[model samples]
Each structure stands twice: as C-alpha cells, then as structure tokens.
Target: MKVEGIAAIVTGGASGLGLATAQALAGAGAKVALVDLNEQGAKAAAEPLGGIGIGCDVSDAASAEAAVARAAEAHGPARILINCAGVATPGRIVGKNGPLDLSVYSRVIAINLIGTFNMMRLVAAAAQSLDPLDGGERGVIVSTASVAAYEGQVGQAAYASSKAGIVGLTLPAAREFAPVGIRVCAIAPGIFETPMLLGLPQDVQDSLGRSVPFPSRLGKPEEYADLVMSIIRNPMLNGETIRLDGAIRMQPR
Candidate 1:
C-alpha cells in the first residue's frame, strides 16, 4: 500500500472523487488505470496523470471484466482497486404523483449498488492472484457510499437504498477476503462539491454545506482522496464504512 510502483484501478476516474483519487495515486507513483463510461473524459483525466484510461460500464459484468483485464495488461495486476462508479438518482417509492416509476428505482439500484459489486468482485479476483506485498497484504479495495445510506432525507428512497447496500457489503467482503490478505473498506461521504452536488442551486448547495456540524461547508474531492490514502496505509482499518460527513446526520426534508 505504499503506492510506489504498485498498480491501481480507479473506477469513475473521469471526474469528482474518483478523479481526485486517481490523481493522488498517480502522484504517489502508482501505475494507475482510469476507468469510466465517458471514454473521452477518461482520456482527458488520464493524460496528465500518466495513467491508462479505459472505457467501462461498471454495471456490466463483461465491461468490468474487460476493463480489469486491460488494466492488468497495461499496469500488471492491480493491488489497489477503488470503486467510485455510482449514479445518484433521487426518487421516492411513493411520490406526490403516486407510486414512483419502477424503472427509475431499478436503474438506480443497477448502477449504484450492483455496479459497485460488479467492479469489486472482478477486481478482487484479479488482486487475489497476486503475491502479497508487505505485511502479507495482497491488495486493498476502497468503495464509495453516501451519508444518505444512514440518514436519507425525503425523496431519497432509491438512492439511499443503493448506498445502504454498499455500506452493508463492506464488512462481509472484508471478512471474505481476509484469508487472501485483501482488505475491503468503504467511505460514506457527506455533501461534497462534486458535479452532482454542484448541480444544485448555489443557495441550496450553501445550505447543504452549512448542515455539516463543524466545518459548516461541503467536502472537497481531494479530502476524500486523503482518507483513501490513510486507509491504504493503515492495514487494520478493514470491514468498516468510515463516514466522511464532517458530523452531519441529514434531517428529513
């Protein structure tokens, strides 16, 4: 996990938290692979990082497999896999217009929940085959959830459920991978100044930031990357979902 000369794969690496993580990993001398649905965006993001950019749909098993394969071909078997590919679709099971669209709910789950799992399993399989590094650590896998998983506000049924599934998955995955010297951890972030949150009105974004207890501001993508670096360094921190929420428990909206 020193990162120097190691291979890493960062999903959703074209933008936001994943992009920041990719930058951090590359800066730390890791051979990085940037995977995203937006091939052009991935290319742009990977160019300066000196990492390979791979077009991938995390929800598709074949796509995930191929992406992992290509990354291995380019950078050797990856020992660090970060799962940041997710979609945030806000919807209520029962809305003002009655029941919500079933398709919307399904799509959110497919992209956010299943997509994380698809990439994790595929990447972990590849990592498992690699020989252990220092401290018998073969690899580390970091995934992204959301504070919504714990304190979902109104109209966050689909999004919250998908994130909660990710939170639930961490411990089991870590436990399962323990024998292989692989670690699985997740970060449940609060409101951050990513494209998703920034899309809201400025006032809305300001209010959301103020909701955080101490910082009273939104998180930066680089801050998320810093915690990821810590997780990579500290081998004891496994099977846990650390909240990067700055002490915010969302209120019912």
Candidate 2:
C-alpha cells in the first residue's frame, strides 16, 4: 500500500529500530506516531518528523489501548504497525546464583512477546474498518525478532523464547488477517548496532561485526528500515519472517 498520507504506528519509537522506522515513514509522507515508554524522548524524536509521540507501556492492556486510541485521534486509523519495542535482558534459566527470578522471565515475555501482540491486535482492529488501499490491503504489520530465536546462546533463554514467540505469531496472524486485507511479517535481525550492542566495549562490538560472513559488519538501522519499506511496497510478502542477518548463523555461546 502507498505510505503517503496514511497513518503509521511504530512502537519503541523513542530509539533504535523504531526511531529509524518512524523517520523513514515520515520521510515517505506518512503521518507517523511514535509510541514509547520514554514520553520525552518520543516527543523529541517525533518533532522534527512532524509527527506526534505518545508514552505507552506496550505490555499493559490499558496503556496500549489508550496509546492506539491517542494515535488514531491525532492521525486516524493506522495503516502500518511496526512492532519494535523489545528488551534483551540475558540470563540463564539456572544461573550461578541459582534459578533465575520468575519475574525476570515474565518481564521479558511480557515486553517482547505480549507487547507485540497487544499493539498489533489493537492497530489491526482499527485498520480493518478502514477502506482498502491499492491492492485491497487495509494495513501491514512488521514485527521484530532475533536470530537467537533459532540458535539461542547459553544466557539467552528468556530473550530467545520471547523472540521465538514473535516468529511463531507471524504466519497465524497473517492467515487470520488475510480476509481483512491486513498482512503480517517479521524480521529476525542478527547483530545490529543498537544502543544495547553499542554499550559494549569497542573491541567487543568490532568482534561482533566481524562475525557476519559477507558484509563483515553490524547491520545498520537504515538497512532494516529499507527492508520495511520493501515489505510495505510488495503485496505478496506476507506470513513470512525474513532474516536481516548477513548470512550469520549464531554459534552457541
């Protein structure tokens, strides 16, 4: 569907992948809404883009509902929903300190997995009521996953499981939304230069970059944004999780 003049909602829009996507969508003439926990940051990011920002906790039902409603009020029903809000707190199921806290696992799942679904469901519900666009498409949803979903390392039990749930949700959602002209897809990024990765030592970051087979560098946020645009433009791409990794199959660390 054409992005120009349509409303788009991006979760985690304060920073990282979500911020990059909000900028891209705004550049394409879409009315962008940045939904994030950092209200100030979201407003700051959305200002130059000429869009609105809302503070939202995606894991909470009421917060997410209110956020989506606020975006619709300002920009109309969202035609594009990008699920980029996630956390990567790594810990083993049974760590040196003994079993990990149950809340820790629940937190990861709540924010990463449940949060994606919360935003998707609410956005799609609104999008379906709108008239179809070019190819009988009412809306499109792009969710974020990780290569860890496939090959999780030692300490990434919770993170991997959360991402795996996203991967799992893509197809069923697409199939269900098909009749409504709403598409669902996902991206499993390998190692990107997100704030979390950048916080590591320089040498460690470089090592991670060198692990990619061909590009031999970390994935750029713009590159991911580019793929999102491609998915939005291509009508046949649905119910699939494309890997944005540069041919990197993560080892079992």
Candidate that scores best on TM-score: 2
Q: lDDT score, residue 83, model 2?
A: 96
Q: Can you write out model 2's per-residue Cα lDDT over 97-141, one digit (the tens) per residue?
A: 999999999999999999999999999999999998877999999
- Tell me model 1's lDDT, rounded to 2 decimals: 0.93
Clashing pairs in 2: none
As a whole number from 0 to 100, the lDDT of residue 128 in candidate 1 is 91
Count clashes in each candidate, considering only residues at least 3 apart in sequence or on different chains: 0, 0
Report the C-alpha lDDT of model 1 over 85-113, residue by residue, as the tens digit.
88877777797899999999998898889
Best by lDDT: 2
Relative to the true structure, how large is the alpha-carbon lDDT of every model?
0.93, 0.95
